[model samples]
Target: MTQVNTFQLNSSKDEAQKAAFQLSAPQDDCAVMFASPHSGRHYPDEFQSLLRVPLMDLRRVEDAFIDQMISPVSELGIGTLSAVFARSYVDLNRSETELDSRMFSDGAPTPAGERSPRVEAGLGCIPRIAASGQDIHVRKLSRDEAEARLQEAYRPYHRALTNWLNLIKRRCGRSVLIDCHSMPSLVAGRRIRTDIIIGTRHGASCDEGLARTVENHFLALGYKVARNIPYAGGYCTQHHGRPLEDRHALQIEINRRLYMDEDTVRLKPGFYKLQSDMKALGLSIMNWAEGTRMLNSQRT
Candidate 1:
């Protein structure tokens, strides 16, 4: 069993010290890190009490078992960071400034200028609705409540992620951050479906070659792959990716219908095959990283 270092938050001041993510270190340190920001299933009792929608309804926003699909990557000597709090509670992928002012009773501390298209879409840092479009809270939250979630959850996850990547870069001279996620099978009115979508903010978040390598790997395996279509990465990918600095970030959106029952959020017969494919992909990524590092060294 993989050892997970979990961080639990309490309802008091002392709980604020706990980190917001569960990290599984690789057996051997490498230049790659995998992060599953939305796969968190741990729902704090406090957050649960505030929910206006059913628990199942709120789970619609979750990436479901996406963390598990990529957890085995640690065995390839790549560290894995997964959130311990659900995205509905506090989206780890969103920027702290992405808070929607309308969702709060006292108004947000930050100005509306920080609001982006995502904030308008009801999918801001503190979401206004579940993935199913159901209201999340019975009433508007206080600004303090929103701040607390960010302090306890959002900030720590990103802090740890940033630290992990920086450490990997210092150790290996370059680092790759793979932001993993799962998308709902039925995206608004789409008959043709892709098995995987790799987003690098249309080549701004990572090297074009790296994104192509990932796309080609999935394609070679007979999986339909797309790049920056409906999804072109999110806050994490855009914020962390610094191609000029040798820090690459890639957002991978897996189609939930391929491996699990999206409604029940359970594994199906195809789960094992998907998991196997992911591990293979992870190895391929590591090999590519090694090759890139060698090429860079030779150039130097």
Candidate 2:
């Protein structure tokens, strides 16, 4: 294990109402950073007042407790960044440019050609609908409202992420971002439910070996692991993953059914076991990073 002091800092409520995200750091930095962009549960009053759907419906979209699942990484001397604002408020994983024009009264800045499939499905940066297809807003929003969310939440989160990754890289010569998420047990018609899915955008986001290492970690735990099936990584994986540049990003999606009561959004009996397994996984990755450092030293 990497030896370092243990420190955790949460934003003051008065400063920004518990910050847009919580950053936990170890005394000595390592090559890995864990991020949970969708696990946020905070719903601001202004955002809640416009909702057409019930709060429970919006909660369905959260990765729910995933941040807590990966919280063990901080104990292993790896840093973690977890969003405080709910994903329904503004998705930190999405590109700021992914705006759905139809949901805004003033029209989106993105051209039709630039709209992604996610946007078409109403899962853009500012979501138009929940994962269950319920319209989120009772009325169309002004462009200013959308922009404000991005300015207040989205950009700052990414800025902090980028800064952390860069600082880690400078200290360790490389950096890896593990973007954590959770998926519903059943996705409409899908029958071959997997316990875990690791996405590297078909090897575009991170080195194939790194992806395989993560896959193997889960497989070793006797869990059914799939690669790039329904999910092949998202914006965070695509945007930040650059293996050639010594910056790698991977997305890990845990089946919500594995650790939480899906309908109630509560922890399952198996939650502790799952968390322990993930902690072991993080330690394995840290060992791999140590080996990489040795290899880089040998080459030099």
Candidate 3:
């Protein structure tokens, strides 16, 4: 039997258990599903001692508080899925086969498929190190240990996501999986950058119409939004997005500097503003998806 994790969202005499991911609805039938794969913070104590950097610094790569922002999307009548296992523990956006041979003592079998540049950079299914290129541990882990994590953490998250997407598609006859993520405040010290990056794998992951609807929402808010630059989607978007099948996936990357103190990792004064903007955008996207054929539209 598959083990399911039970969490409470509201008052109810009877309890229900979902998988590691969660779903909330307001009884409104919306065809969009929101997902935050790298925003998890449930780090295991056993992995703490292995970290070469401080715990606070270790989380510099994490999409801090993203779960808090997207959690309310459920109340807007859409489904929201979030991973509870920290990205440092196991990244759900990566392919299950993306194991780093160097991270294991006996080495690992290479994954099938074109070797993604991200995996080559040590951000594979089993990352060799955390962000900042800091080594995760002092010694190489056993292959069995790596495989165990794949079975226990990596596989379950994707399995849950797949099942959820399948259900949404069944009900709506079409579904959009917005894979939510947050990027570093500054990468290689670029002074000016995009406020949001909506990646559709350069139009392979989602319909152009859907992408335009999302992109316009941010543009209407007067926030700078870019397409397929710096980020053109990651594993989640690449793996699941299938516009031909009427299931589109888009990767939405919000700049961390907008809502949080990059150094302190705390919500900034503009945090509420950004959240409000997202709320408005979310509503617009939901409404647009309900009545329009976004699959037929294009931004430029």
Candidate 4:
């Protein structure tokens, strides 16, 4: 059994446990799935009860319109799984085990190991601080509350993701994952001039050739490109990527300023062009999948 068919519902009862993620291509037609874990914007009422800072402040942490940006890829037979619940509510990019002991009533479902640097910085699976460094909840959460978010949001999303990837592997002989995300144009008050950053976990997550090919696509499109600097991907890239199993995961970070007004959290005139470019990017991956499938047949 793969990671798929292994996770059981942690149901402390989330309102939309089954509906939190939307999978557009259940058929797995192209053997590629574009997932946007941080693009979710929905803030549940139960979550609203925990708010300390204004919601807009928390919104800054979102990948913003990345879900919509990757939506077009489904048209080309790439499965798309979009998390609809807000990342501030429960970051899907993080490990459910990455908890902050201080955030919970009983010191959390505390990690059995030392806390990771990101968790210490308050960016765990259940985030403690907003993008602006403001606290998210006014009070410490109950152990049940923390577990519910993990069970409801984190586990379900991964369950569906793993199942889909395994299915693609079984049916197509290869599986590809394009983990979609957006980065702020400015970090720590400095501008990031690169139009895109592609991360393959220093080639651990994917073959260097495929990573280079994807990077070259954006570069040929006149976009400045960077590799593994500042953002080298997160739990998703590290966990799902299994090159030995013929499964590859690559993370693409789009500069938000290229498509949206950051302060207002609204799309700019550039969003459409970028959306179009995303469709092209998906097509490129599909073409690669086809070629890879053909080569595998020859090898066999």
Candidate 5:
């Protein structure tokens, strides 16, 4: 067994009661919604003890500080929803149907539908492993228990996200959802790795123009931007993104090495600079969302 970082055999469901996601700087009728699905670090003392690995080791799979990087999005009058529970608890960016059987001690949970490759790869709504393939529990979970986790953590997060988008669409003619995330510095890329990878589900989720708009924003910053390469998008982009209906979605994957100490999970000297840059990035999207075209088309 991996060394337990914090051991608590008694973690309450109350931990799950904590809002899976948070909304900050809410503008009731904003055209754009920024979401940080991975930047949650509120590890309860009991939950921490249950981890079969060191706390630092468990964090290897986390998108540390992703919420903070995109936090400025709300200040620009855009709505930002961020998850507060670590991805190890429940992954909001994954499809509800993506549940794994291997992690369940009993048979797979009931109501399995639309199983995805992500589920097979161990990254599911109730993930069997963290983003880095770390096993979350020392023992397998019962199917009933798995379902409980999904119902408690995964379901409500999406509910909030969906409600938010609908509200924005009611106000604006349409809504744009930017699913924010961070990636490890290294991957098995065919060529040179990129600093940023923008996934729009091969443009099926968002209009090409809108996708290009975001790509150009990062490009203008002189950051290496790649489109639909190693990461083309995940469950949130695939499930929520609807270009034809005018609801656009894009997934932004920032390289973690850019701002954090991956080994120790600490903020690097570059953290503030990166946050500053992201603020500019967020502001640009806000300005674009508040443009005359979108504002004039709002459902008045």
Candidate 6:
């Protein structure tokens, strides 16, 4: 399961299929799925022309090679989904309604709730800021253009995820989504010593035992682990994490300093070691799935 594969942004001039995401589907017994939403590197030529900031700035926001880090894990009977389109084009983590009206010429979708802090910060579903901490758009976007990004990328991703999870629930009586991400080593110029941050929306998103299972793996590997300090799960976790309904989600954030150089967006010597450890972790998750399966059978 400890296989390595990189889905590079602008990976080639080969004119690859303009798919929004790359999916390594599970063969059977998909009680678990590991997702890397922000790891996509492909930037559409159309999207590139609309941005004001340099590509490197948007690169800063990526989870980098997280899809590669977990792609190998799919072999262990787990499905994997990685966005091939960069988050700068459309963020998969935010709700579709989380659009900023200020970025559009006519108007963006009217949000259901009061405006959120993310939208105000220019980090909406259709983002205004590249990871470089600068505005991403050179000109105001048309509402139709914004809607197309959602129609093309956002809706499809969530639909696939829903179809997969629902099928797993029907087959296995439960499903768990491990929404994976990588965090910057330094926040506000201060280095973050904690290597992993697990979020379960303060115990509401997932069962405590499931969250603990993920945490213990990183801890055993000698990585510093924290819970819900900076991140307490995003939309994927909140929307799907429902232990009462036999669905669960937990967001895992790995400090990028452990395995990559943030400035260069390149892998470091530490990557191999981390990769091996993650392979072991994936196996443990497969075991956990079997354990839950057995427990469900007994309950029935």
**lDDT per model, in order?**
0.83, 0.83, 0.75, 0.83, 0.73, 0.83
Instruction: Give the best candidate by TM-score.
Output: 6
Q: Positional deviation of 244 in candidate 4, in angstroms?
A: 2.0
TM-score, per-candidate, Cα-based? 0.92, 0.92, 0.87, 0.92, 0.86, 0.93
Model 5, residue pairs in steric clash? 6-48, 6-49, 7-49, 8-49
lDDT of 1 by residue, 1-300 (tens): 256666543233332345578897754448888899998776777777788888888777788887888877777787889887788888888888888888889987556526688888888888889866878888998988888888888888898899888888888888898999988878666653888999999899998878878988899989999999888999999998999999999999998889888788778888788888888888888888889889999999
Off by over 4 Å in 3: 1-19, 25-28, 109-114, 293-300
Task: Pull out the clashing pairs in model 3.
Answer: none
Poorest stretch of ten by lDDT in candidate 5: 1-10
Question: Which ten residues in a row are the worst by lDDT in model 1?
Answer: 8-17
Question: Per-residue lDDT tens digits of candidate 6, residues 135-253?
Answer: 89899999889888888778888888888888888888888899999999888888899999999999989888788888999999899999999999999999989999989899999
Name the lDDT value of residue 33 in candidate 3.
78
lDDT of each residue in 1-300, candidate 3, tens digit only: 122352422123332322445445323356787888887766655566577767776577778788778776666777777776567767889877777676777867445423667778878876766666777777887777777667766777788778778877777767788899999867776754789999999999998988998999899888899999979999899988999988899999999988898787788878788777777777887776766644443421
Looking at model 6, report the run of 10 residues with the lowest lDDT sum: 1-10
Q: Per-residue lDDT of 28-147 in model 2, one digit per residue for the tens?
A: 557888889998887877788899888888888899888888888888888888888889989888888888888888877445414889888888898889866889998998878987
Q: Who is ahead in TM-score, 1 or 6?
A: 6
lDDT value for model 4? 0.83
Question: Could you tell which candidate, 3 or 6, scores higher by TM-score?
Answer: 6
